[model samples]
Target: MKTQVVIIGAGPAGLLLGQLLYRAGIDNIILERQSGDYVLGRIRAGVLEQVTMDLLHQAGVDTRAHDEGLPHEGIELLFKDARHRIDLHGLTGGKQVTVYGQTEVTRDLMAARAAEGLTTIYTAAPVSLHDFDTAKPTVRYQKDGATHEIACDFIAGCDGYHGISRASVPGDALHLYEKVYPFGWLGVLADVPPVSHELIYANTSRGFALCSMRSEHRSRYYLQVASDQKVENWSDESFWNELRLRLDPEACERLVTGPSLEKSIAPLRSFVAEPMRFGSLFLAGDAAHIVPPTGAKGLNLATADVGFLSRALEIHYREGSQSALDRYSELCLRRVWKAERFSWWFTSLMHRFPENGEFGQKIQEAELDYLVNSRAASTSLAENYVGLPLESF
Candidate 1:
């Protein structure tokens, strides 16, 4: 098969790029290894930055999101049994964060794609990159045990970490920067509704706990755990007990415990690939970088990258010039770094570090207290969480 552009992976980045190209009347094909159901079901980041919401609104997919999504003015911080609420709206001149899961975003994107009746290949595992450096890049894949070849003018390697496209680039051709944290997060979803009206990020001597929810009836939460933790080790009682410790007395008991719907421990990581391009093949989203879930910035990062690159591709096609395409890597790296720094700041502030020196821990706590009470400090966070850097636009 042939196309003007072949996007690898049907996740947010690839899917959004495809939709954008569709709107621009540029034909493209997306090949995803996972089934559509799995892709749409995998629970991930929920916080949608202001810029992300703007993109969705402009794309005509925000109607359902706006109707069902949870709009949060700001987040609460819990420490030493005291709660501090930061007014994100007041700080950032009305910027807000939307609590819509990554899975929901994928669900919306899938529905949008199906409604459009565009052709896409799911369960197509990419095996190799063919002629990636040439004008025409080919993706060799096996779908249903049958080998197939997809050729295109340019390939958007939106496939995530552990994807073939990232590895296909020779080691010497790319510079990899990686930071793996000492601990991971044990995320849980309960059928019971959230105990509080706002999200609470708590730092406790035991560990860190995050309080989030999907809807009025479903609560999503997390606990800090060992990086090598196995799901079988954490029981319902322990999960609730940890939640009890991190939460304040006022809201802790009201946190009605319910059946655990989802459970997994994701390792904390901060990674960025420099110059996310190799000839005509460019990396996007997780393929190019990863921000810890601390700031709920992963999906936003992908949306920002695809939004920028998609427009760049449109310009290249309309003007028959490659300047935008040539600058794609640099363009994406700027936002990627901004998100990376913010995620790091949020995580470092809220999560307990076992190896932290006494002064380091005190500094973090002091900074958190100041930020929560000071409009200037909260505004700094509000701006970053609202979206990637505005200067990029």
Candidate 2:
């Protein structure tokens, strides 16, 4: 089969990119190694930066997001037995984040693709890229135990961190930077009203905790745990008890607890692969970078990467120009590095580091104190949290 673009992932990045391309009269197909059900089943963060919401609207998939997604004007930072609210909307020129789940975003994109008859091949396994460095690029994969090949003008490697896209790049040609944190987040999703209207990020002598939500009725909470901690060791009661100990007295009073709908421990890490583009193959989303979830930048970064990638491809096909494509990596990395710095900084401020010792903890406390007390520092945090402006291609 032959197409203008072959996308090697059906995650939000690939699906959203496909929607954008299809609307532009560009031919593209998405290949996924997993079933659609499996993709939807994965739980993820819900906070959406303004740029992400804008792109979703651009793709004609924001009806549900705007209608159902909660708009948070601020986030609460808890420390020293008190809660400090950072007014994100007030600080960022009336910009606010929407609490829309990544799962819902994927669902919306998938539905749009199906409604428009766009092609997405689920269960396409053993995918491989060939000759991406040359003028002609091809994608090979296995479908129902049968090998198939697709010749394409361009390949979007949106297949994510563990997918074949990034791994296929020759080691000598790729430069990698990574830092794994000493802790993990033990997260729980429950069917209950959220503890607060807006998200709360807390730093306690015990550890770090975050109170977030998918909606008014579905709450998502996380507690920092040892990286080697086993989920099986913490029962629902124990999780709730530990969470309460870290929260402020008022929050703990109003906090609701219930049987967890889902529970898991995810290790924290910051990873970035320099030069997101490799010839005709361009990596987007987790294939190119990853951020600690403290700042909720993972999905947002992926959204931005594809927004740039889609526009670049659109200009190439419509105006017969390669200017945007040529500048894709440079433009993307500028934003990527900024996000990496923010996530790293935010994580260090909120989480406990055994190696940091007492002096490190004191420094973290001082930084938080300054961030909440200083208007400039608060504004800086708000701007980064809501996301910086997108670069026009």
Which candidate tops TM-score? 2
How much lDDT does each candidate structure score?
A: 0.84, 0.94
| Runs with alpha carbons beyond 4 Å of true place in candidate 2 | none
Task: Please give the distance, in angstroms, between residue 64's alpha carbon in candidate 1 and its true position after superposition.
Answer: 1.1
In each prediction, how many residue pairs overlap at the backbone (N, C-alpha, C within less than 3 A)? 0, 0
Native-to-model Cα distance after best TM-score fit, residue 328 in candidate 1, in Å: 1.3
Q: What is the lDDT of residue 108 in candidate 1?
A: 78
Q: In candidate 2, residue 124 scores what lDDT?
A: 95
Question: What value does the lDDT take at residue 231 in candidate 1?
Answer: 83
Measured with C-alpha atoms, the lDDT of residue 280 in candidate 2 is 98
